[model samples]
Target: MQVQFGVLGPVVAWDGAGDAIALKGPRHRAVLARLIIARRRVVPVFRLVEDLWTDPPADAVGAVRTFVAALRRALEPERPPRAPARLLLTEGPGYALRAEPGAVDAWRFEQAVAATATLPPKEVFARLEEALGWWRGPAYAEFADQPWVRAERSRLAELRLHAVERQAEARLGLGLAAEAVPDLDAHVAEHPWREDAWRLLALALYRTGRQGDALAVLRRARTLLVEQLGVDPGPGLRGLEADILGHAAHLAPAPGPGGAAGRVWAQTAAAYDRTVPSGARVRLESTVGLLRNLAVTGGSGLQAARRHRVAAVAAAEELGDAELTARVIGVYDVPAIWTRVDDPEQAAQVVAAAERTLTALPPGGHEAARARLLATIALESRGPLPQARRAGRTPSARGPQAARQAEEIARRLDDAALLAFALNAVFMQTFHRAGLAPRRDEIGVELVALSARHGLATSEVLGHLIRLQARSALADFPGADHHATAADRLAERHELPLVGVFTQWYAALRTAATGPAAAAEAEAAYRNAAARLDGAGMPGLEHGLLPLALLCLRVQHAQPAQAEEHTDWGPYEPWARPLALLAQDRRSEAAAALRKVPDPPHDLLFEALWCLTAQAAIAVGDRQTMERAYIQLTPAAAELAGAGSGLLTLGPVSKHLSDLATALRRPR
Candidate 1:
């Protein structure tokens, strides 16, 4: 007869047919519970004697043996007389209860919780929810008062708390931070000393945009720790507080539906695998090729997309089709950064791969594949053009040539997606030069129309985003806000969470531009946006962006600039350092530094730096540098500074041009 033990709630046993096994009395149940807690290990008769009674009775040993016999008969009613008991076996000193898998609820619950560790957030949450459901009340509930069960009960309770906290973490990972708040609130209330619980609750509140409430939760946690535990909160809580204060980007949920999209891709991949005919290499190659493009724009993690790229490239090469190989290679996995160069090594590899694939294909016939390769090459190689130009070197036209060719081919092919991609490449190449807002606005219009017509979610988001930047740079806040609203709505609807980061930062920049009164609020917004970026784990995206924003605000609003606040200015260091020095009243040093600062690189950052330089030169009475900055910034005078990224802005360029006109005695 099969038997299932239940110690998670009450110390009870049920037979194979779901009938209750009579446990006789409290002492009888205690003996069985003691054996179960020993985990199938032999418990000496003497130990059982001590466990059953605080003071051993004269026939305590005999009483234990009788109880064990009763348990064996009840647990295995079909056992023949004198037959060795299977469920309860007699050892040399005492006995052991043999429990099989799923026979013990407590053991099964523990196993389920352990299995959730490697799973992604959604699966982890699901598995943990199921595991936690196995707990009826508590471990060994009816045996709760027994001295032998005390330690085990406490351990099980702690495990339950851990499971609760992990589930909350999974919720946060799934972008359900608001949903995690109430449970975490109840959890921390129940377990006041659990710092992790308090931290999670605070984080949830922060994600929901309740900054004050989040900080209050942390404060309450600190008070509890100091009052109850007589110690400070641990490093995790402290670090989280600092991260929250700074608006660290890592705290934000992933920008897109990476987890959800991964799940969808997994299902689609399985379907393809199931339908593919066995030994059909060409079909397999075709399947891989189709999946490769999906993975690139699937909003999944980079590693997953890279895996698909590798597999697709390998399959394409195996088929020995040059056009197919080039197409596969052309669909790069890395997300493009428009504001600045981030990953040079990966970009270089992509350019080299595309070039080599293009060389392998017959030049004339593979127009679609060739266009894709050209666009990818342009995107990867466009970064250094501005720097080369700044060094008085005639910049290579290869990148621009590729972007033009890709766009031309895409237009002829009548493929909207292809044209959108090629236009994106053209945008990347042209964005390196300053004073191109009008041109960028034109591209934005076409991308929006094309992507909307094709129902391409990602490309449509990109379109609205580009329009937002161009509008902001043109000093059209209402137009910028319109596109920002559109982009944000699309982002949420399509699971592109990262779009909010840019929109939020622009909100801050707009706030700062409202004048000096809004500086503090704007600063907080920037820090929060930075935190979101950090949470997204894309470091280069936020690099120097914050400092530049702060500096722009300070200089524009005539606020006192603190040089020490910007310890790391990243790529803007050379251009921004002198301005910071000049702000500190170091005229000679500022002028010398200004002289060393070369003609500004023509990139997204160019107009902002030029305006900053003009401000610093005005302060130092350096007409030579002022005139230089004036000439460079003149064409962009009608534009807004640093608004090309749809992220940050430094007010209008005309404002800086006005300052230069008054200082250098130059007519504007």
Candidate 2:
């Protein structure tokens, strides 16, 4: 059976009989459009409800279901015997389209262009030409007045232009200069002000040895530029024109210093080494400049790798010392991996150089320098224990240990800000390992006080403080409120995305102590936090506190899907599975899942608490299990109680906990 989907150009379709299938009504078209693009994937009913009704009247869900049914019927007017679902099928919690790959015209266009990348120049040109020929006019022209369709049409148009540009480049590279010239000229006539197209045209003309024509083209471009925007051609365009006139050899683009985009890449690398923070305005500006430069000098494959190495080394040099340079290079490794440009040999060599530099440092001569060296080593090695051990040692027992000596020097030098920064890094390592919470808290508080005194608003410090406070409250430690309030105020002032997450966790804990209404409030807060987090591009893997928040909120809300979506237990898959199963009310499955969680390290309080909570929830008849959970959580409960929330009543695992317990107690 034949069915066509079109998002690019006019809305058109044909049925199995090859008869025109007309789609009428704006909203109906929109519903179909969304389903087609999100093809095969089940877009949740709630999301569709939101789309169809901006201020959905009561029965929004029902209205959405009606729309789905209507769309399905429209697509399959004459359902054949034993035929598969024509357009849509009900899947878990939502609907999915059943269209085959390339059944959609939009998908066909993309496939054609992607195939062109591997084909010969003539073939590439032909494929793109055919793909472009599919467009009958402005995309979804009948629905152009609709906001979503308009935006989608704009995106498709951009894609078409990109395909054209790439095809033109291939044609020119194949020495088909005269062949590309007319099409490029037509493109220029349509988009006369686009400098890249003009540049391509000029290059194509020059390549055919039409030097005079190329110069004339540049002259026309300059005139157009002056008339349109009252500006001369940019440096690159002007340089190209000069080259053509002088008959000079074409210049090869040079790899940037350290392979960074532009001058600022080198500058930012230097600044990073000099103790400047990551998100500073100066560093960001430099990063932007470097990116712009890199775009201008396009390199592929091995050339790209060489350019990145150059950039890394330049950054290392700007950082000043050998260790700092190595650390800067290590930072480059993350992007290199994503871009598939990582060089293990180069990385190892840099690390070796850093170690040598550290080894060669004179005893007790420079405390700050020594600390910097150690910090760089710690960062490069990715071994926190080794770093902690190294940091624990003094440069000389009597003369000056690096950490202590560095602290003293910071005090004497009136550099509290730097002192705070140094201490924060140390705290990060300590907090990650077992049995270091007290020390972590002390150092974190000190850092916060120092930062506050120095008029600093550090998100890093605030985030650490929030985690420490939550831990302290859980462990029943002192000063939880002070830390919690401090974290809350800082997060509110900055509109920090993570703060909402922590706030929800705090609310859940409070609710469990108080009552169901409080628990419901916590659930609402968690939902709000999740919505806010949806678009924010926080690091996917390094969400240290978010998992903890999700665990707490899951108990409060009893929503398994929400819990699963946020749980990121790196390498602890077995442990996470039980928690997920339990949250979903699969009692026996959840209990079975728990055997996978390895025994916790003795000092890891939170892990123990979670285990106890799980065990108690799974074995309701066993008073011993509940008692043990109470015993483990008592200290944490007391600490939170002391922080002035009366809800800190600890015992028979509250309503959320009781639900799990009840589920577990039911007949198998």
Candidate 3:
């Protein structure tokens, strides 16, 4: 009997006939997944209790044992009654699943990565392809939303990414860099922060006799390291760069950190006082340089950026150098989030001051650079209020055309910095001009490369946020959460103030859609986020806030106070007139008022509005209103049936729609 058990993506068992055997249920599937990841290592019962349940049941031990027993039966239906389990055995301390190496897909992938040393280049590539093919989705994709499962899946996903990185290296190693050039180029483009991959791409270029191209890669990498990280390239990379410059004959491919420790850490680490000559006394020039260096290092966060800006201001005042002043301000005036330090008004003031200063500067390259900086600042500091967004028809909103134009301009300029700036600029515009930017998710990947390659800290934060927004907009909640996690981590590590509000909004939406106490928490989060949204001054807040208020009302998370007789939804007053009617206890009028709403934008809010309308109409026994509303709402209703909160009501929303269809048909 040939059976394959895979935990590479979904936990599944398949027979030799190429059909998947069903594996189901929350707890049961989790138990099997844990065993597969455990990889025959004994997992203690105590560990299982904590991993499986946040608040373990009083009979948690009994439940875990029950789940394991069920899994054993599902795995081996022919096992003799009362016989000791052979495959899943209860060992001295705990339980273990004994399976051959090839049976588990994760183990196979690990093996392929490990066995590359013994295999030829083509063979290594083939094995990696085979290993990668086994993944049906994200590792333990079905269980990823579960906190316990998330940690393990993230670990596996990283391992999978490394495998891809290694496979690309193999392609370069096999003298196939010409064939590998396009892929390696794109790979490095998407993950430009990865110095090892950059090194590989450079080696590929040199091996292909494109020595000049190889030098260009190293120079850009070196510049990015100095500009973004405030550190020089590591010794191996520097040595390789030098050798490439000299057209060294022995320029062999050197792997990144995967090869050695020397490939990773910068060798420019000086012990102490070496530069100061044993405390002869530090000077103002050196101090200012350190402050300037602090501006570029990625992980130092918002305070570091501010410190550089302030110090540079003082230096300019003392020295009376206009160009130096502009350069410092230009570098640090990047768009970022703040907790409370710089609110909307203060940010507006900063923008005004910067504009005034720019007018005083002599027009030249400095002016152009200052203008670009001003554009970035305005993007963060001034745009539209939260309510300015509407998914209205627009012939000009097609995103790819604008992005391609910017891309072409950047390329024609032959400037990496300009290209990085263009990518981010185009990325921000996608949200503002919305025809539901197709493949918006891919933008995050390019931004990731751009930020890393050029050391753009704002792009790093925006890249993650873009993915978060794209994932949520698509209703891929699990993927959204993944991006949210990365965004939060980067925000904290980098001290990004602007990222907090955007991440908060995403988190609230996800929680509102699915949390156990969805209404109460989501309402609070959305209200706080609404204030921040107003502060952001980005377009779409008008459309964005309407949904939140409607959701809050629909969930009964926070009902409108009786004192509020009218809802001033700004330009959307006509479309939102029903909320005011409902708040005033005019349920009949509320149902009638909704007739003014135009065709919905075909987004989550579309479902929210119609569901609320159907509820209001039902209260008034307006069968005609219900029938008309349900016709437009049916498809969205069916898709969102299981989703809780006001987006689609929890109980039988689909059933309710069906029943209404039946009632409408039966009546005169």
Candidate 4:
């Protein structure tokens, strides 16, 4: 018979035979409760005695044994005839109760709460509803006065409140706001001091087109706060009031036939459209505000619209009006996306919206003046040719007439900081694309020249440029050492994460250039960077760059198993798997896998370099193929030749390339 015990609420013990198993007395109940909660585990006799009697007589152990015997008899009245004594077993200084997980109401409650985490609103609501339904009255009502029971009861009460909140939130999300209102209203009435409940009620009211009522709710909350605690409502509640007041005409709650939550959601969407871009500072402030607000509130309408609103507001602010603020805000958005939202599609959409807004802004008004804004937006967009063209456009220029616009902007922006920013953005976009290494190098030289002229030696812009140079070296480009050394110096001097990334890149390149032993120090540096920065919420730079460097080390070590464990199969999977396969001596399979990798145009140069190197290493006997591979890498090599102090791997990679050249020249 399946029996469930829920004395934690009302004493309810029912079996499949439809008979109530009498659970009587506080001590007897405590014995059963302790045994059930610690089911299949031993509760030492001394521990049980200690729990039952905070200050016990000398015969505490003997008294505990008597209670246990009494509990055994009560649990199995007809056991003497034939039933085994398997329900409770004696263990070393303890007792164990044999029962399934659902046998205890507390266990069931925990299970329900855990199950609701990944489920949709309807499902979560159902589970929580079932769990909450089991509560007939105050938990352990008979023993509420007891210390142990009081603590347990308080814990259950808190869990119940949490479940109720989750259930209300789910109902709101599922467009059942009206149905949730009554329960939520009762909850608010029960605990009038609970701000979250009040907030939920206001949200529901607003959604139902009860804008006046919603405002009234806030006013009531304000009054309640003053009356109860002698303080005004907090920022979140006040902000809701401000939103309603500021956009009253637009927020008139729809008359209810459907759910009020849905209406509220639609209203919020409309509000987002209206208030997002008042000005640069306002937009930035609003975007940052919304992101933070949603994190704390955890409701539907306003929170749901937060990402889109933030993106739109950011976009509107970047329209050549407030360049520095917009750029700073734009950079801040990258980390915010990952930390704030679980939905990748929604996060990506926010970024895309910001990029589109940035792109639509008028260009060439004062490239030098707007250099920071232009550079930040260009980098965020991740497309060099388009950004370069946009940078060139002026009110008077048309067609090829504005071809020199980028250079003009760079020249006019004589500020070293601004020019360096633009160049780094350009370099990032170029290097990210497959075949653009040569172009990246060419542009990089120009940036270096600009840096030299303007004395922009210590900044994030220089860090970015140096990191790119290190990447080129890893791809076996010439003169990578210069960039690597510069990046190292800058990183050491400034103590920045970007420098740490460059250091790893340099270490990896040095390893690849020299031998496995040369890479040990580099590997240690990469590990340190990964530990320090991977999840630390740093923005704009590649957080995964350290992981890539680690993978490079795995290739050097030929540890396929370790590589498989650490490497993620997303962006770097294509390169990672092939590298792993080559390491494992699966040459043909590695080459075949490399062929399937997407050939994004900009990524071609680095891709070709790595692919050719891997192919040559695997097909050591094939001189002709090695020669062909070497020829494909020449353009990238030449591009790296002029690279300066920023290149870290040039020395090691150059050596590897020389060895490959020597191998190719030998008789086949």
Candidate 5:
């Protein structure tokens, strides 16, 4: 006999004739929902009573047993007297509900979702809709607040989200991108933290020709990441933005509503696969191409890269050439830095593995490439641009040297992409490991020229970003603002989502550096920048943004929602945590907290950090702490002595250390 049970929403049951069973009221419904949540496993009567009732009666166990009897009567109303209940079984100390696979809506929903896994595009779309149909409103809406039910609902919601993501992919794959937009929009609204959903949404927008809205969503996501999480955007999202900016051939749509042709990139993959000659060389080349496409194509970069890395290794082994394999490995090396599962502290393990793998490699392309790979890992581990730059001057710093090799090889091979990558390496070096960004105006100009010639939007945006920071540190106000404006404009115009958000942030930092007169304006701008930081991957926004950050602190008006963003700053928590307390009018506590924030070694933000401590201490009547902070400022006094006004716009690198030093040490 067919019995359809749906506990995913309200509890509903019907036998083969589709007639609703006369299940009693709320208690009966609660019993059914709770049992379904337990997935037919034996749930003890005492536990069920605790979870189902906020205030349990003295006879709770007997009450639950009565509810189970009502449930059994409802499940099989016509069962003969003394006939063992088929659906509800009384096990030791508890009861269980057992139904066929398709009987329960929640089980059917999962089954439908699992069925979509290996289906073709058309089938996937149909199955996804079927799975989505089970959600009548949150799973078990009546029991939404029940602690036991909450976990199940959360799991189902997450499952539903995954289903939505997959459904959107199917829609996009079939060239039905516009159809997926509504669901993705809702998905992101409900769950802003899932960057992949944002990525897919942005892509759908781009594919449907809504460039500005696409940029806005990316910016919005950035803001959430920054103001709410104090972090930068993920690489997959960044890569998507870059591709959008450059109008990457791969992202361009295949004509039609059904997406029967899929994305242009898919066509390229097929074409490339066909071009390779059948041999070990073919295998090696195909793997390399797949790695690049996966890395650049947005979404699933790491998983695809890992899979192909092994394939490349197998082909290299078959060909009997270690150098060839090392070169292949080199091509795929940067993925570790950008992988979705990346752990900043875990790079040393990867470095050790790479070193062992390449130790026997001859002094050729492989050795240099491995060194460059290590450099990327080192930079990635430090977290963000400035800190990474400062951290790179260690005894183990080899990225710069290896990058030089890549530059030479690219020049020899006349490869534009590799040359661009190598130029980026040079640019990375200009952040000046000493703490402040040193003068690198020449490299900025060169980057501008290189990136423009090759149509590299990411490079162009970065080039301008570098110029903007350098100009600010040099106290070139008009020039700094000009660079800032240019970067901000380009970031908006191009698909440089991260760069766009960063320009907005750094531009505000520049404004804040203009001093007291600009604080209010800069404060507003800083808030705007925070909103756009999700895609701004490089980090170090805190330094230049400090002036306005202080304004927010001083006024005791900083928003907790925004302050929550920096909670994961780890060791740098003190640098930002006091601002949170200050926002809540906890002055004395903030002052106490500031005293504990130590100056990191080789710290570029050293002067600014101390000055902030001094300012914060003054607010809370901590004269001794203020004096100690001012004393710490003395070391950088001479460096900024000759510098003009507005060093606050200067970053944590050597470039602006003098400006910050000069200003902090000025007579009271």
Candidate 6:
């Protein structure tokens, strides 16, 4: 059987079947309520006696004992004569209530509100609404005049109010400012001292085009604070007031779902579904390409994408149209930088399709289409399949060969988009190795110049993102931040929401690198970024990316890295596990583990893995691994380790290299 308690309204208890436990009299109810407010802590019998009454009779202690007995009988009706109470237990000199999680409505309500910090607007609003529903009325309403319950009651009331404000904040985030206005108006009117509520009400009014009303609300707030509280309005309220007067551009509502580009793609997909036939070979082929690109970048479901890919490839093959096949294969959407191919099986299918088309075309003909297919092969082949890795299959040079052929053809064609495409393929092949930031930097430069000249918005965003990663790796904070800003602006303009995702990650990385003063803030920032990434539905890009970054941050701060280590880091587990072991002070275990791990793979995360290894080696005093890591990391000695991921870093590579040298008895 189960039991539940509620003090959100009058003190009450319900058994497993929802029948209210008859807490006999006022004194019995008071005792039960006091015990509930103890929050599982032991409440001394003497303290309860003083709180229950101002005056005592000769048998007052006996009276207290009788009240406890009655309460136990009501709360635990099934207890045998000799059995002790399960929910309420007597300990030492007091009694404690052992309610489970969610048994108490007040506790459950608080937890729900606390969890909304990192959620998206829609989720935040839903959760906050659920939390507020737990409040039946004033907390401990039956004991409003009692001094004993005063503090707890006040605390819960304030928490409920704060939840209301948080919900309104979420509403504003969801662009529902108009809907938020009514409740906020009531909230501020009833609690005029709450500047946050006032600010939200004003902002909501302003968003709803009531600028004069918004300004008036702020003015009223200022007057209330100055006259009653004897302080000017806080920074937030004052700042909002100033922004309203100036009509700041940022105050406008955010762009609707997916911005302009997303709406267009959605409309197009809908129109195609409504009117286009599967037998329209050419149109279907183009639609399939667009769907595949969306699947990679985001805004498309995986099963649907796979279905489209299969159907389109089959249709093109059945028709024996090489051009349509090439179109389908060549148009795989290039995702944001650092987004490795997650569905390698799908990639292999595309490669097979391209090869079949290549065989159909004459050796010297279809150069443009051939170049695109070759670049696709190069990009897709860069990340080896998990099954191949498990089988210990050595990588072939096919990726590089295809990339080179693509680049040669693109250069001959004198097409900027084609050249940029080939360069991206080359980037995929080369970027996985450690100490290759300089090469990557050169590619980034060419990408930016060429893409900007041709006004390739997607490519331009990609260029800035690549440059941001390279610059961060090369220890140029200013350059990295500059590119990050540019990438953010370009992504917003182009409706590339995922681009902003990476840029936000870069901001967190910068915060984490700012040292101990920002450690807590940095952790919060990383958590929020991870939440946003998850919410965006880009799981492939999110997997292990933030966890690796967090591990790097914790390692630098000399904090406990055990929590981060326990996360399911997928392929990066080998690099992160040893560091976590060292963090727990298991030095010999860390050293042995490091010895068993393979050399870090040459991929986008190569530098990150090596740098993590370098940290573990330093801690475990594994001089040999130190020397190996040193050799790989020394080339980019001035750079910050792991910045290529745009999420987190393990301080500077130079710092680790210097330490490795010192340990190795060599000069820096």
Q: How close is each model in CA RMSD to the real structure?
A: 23.1, 16.8, 19.2, 16.8, 17.4, 15.1
Which stretches in model 3 have alpha-carbon errors above 4 Å? 143-158, 208-212, 252-668
Residues 48-97 of candidate 2: C-alpha lDDT, one tens digit per residue: 77766668889988866777766666678787755766578888888887
lDDT of 4 by residue, 1-668 (tens): 55567765655566655577775666767777766646468888877787788688899888777777776666666678545566777877789887678878777887798789999777888788778887778876666666655666787788888888888877776666556767988998887777877887887667655678778888888899899899878787887788777765533433444446566565665466456765535555555545543432222422444455456545555554554334434433211111112343443344344445445546756345344344434444432233334456421222112223333476675556555555555544444322344565566566666666666554433543444554453354345555656656754664434444434534444544455676677667656655644433333223344555555444444444233545453444664566666656777886776666543223222533354344435443545445554554454443332122221222333444565666766431
Lowest-lDDT window of 10 residues in candidate 3?
262-271
Query: TM-scores for all candidates?
Result: 0.58, 0.44, 0.36, 0.45, 0.50, 0.60
Can you rank all candidates by TM-score, best first?
6, 1, 5, 4, 2, 3
* TM-score, predicted candidate 3 vs. hidden true structure: 0.36
User: Which has the greatest TM-score?
Assistant: 6
Model 6 Cα lDDT, one tens digit per residue, 409-514: 9999998888888988887777545677778888889999999999987888888888888888777879999999898888777667777678888889889888
Residue 638 lDDT (model 3): 30
Q: What are the Cα lDDT values of the candidates?
A: 0.77, 0.53, 0.59, 0.55, 0.61, 0.80
Which regions in candidate 4 have their CA more than 4 angstroms from the true location? 1-153, 156-378, 381-404, 413-418, 429-514, 518-521, 538-551, 554-569, 582-588, 598-613, 620-628, 638-668
Better of 3 and 5 by TM-score: 5
lDDT of 5 by residue, 176-262 (tens): 666677889999998999999999999887776677778888999999998999999999888988888898988866555535444
Residue 121 CA error for candidate 2 (Å)?
A: 38
TM-score of candidate 5 to 2 decimals: 0.50
**TM-score head-to-head 1 vs 6, winner:** 6
Candidate 3 per-residue C-alpha lDDT over 236-316 given as tens digits, one digit per residue, 9 for 90 to 100: 678888888887756644554332332221111122222556422223334444554443333333346454545545555
- Candidate 2 lDDT at 76 equals 86
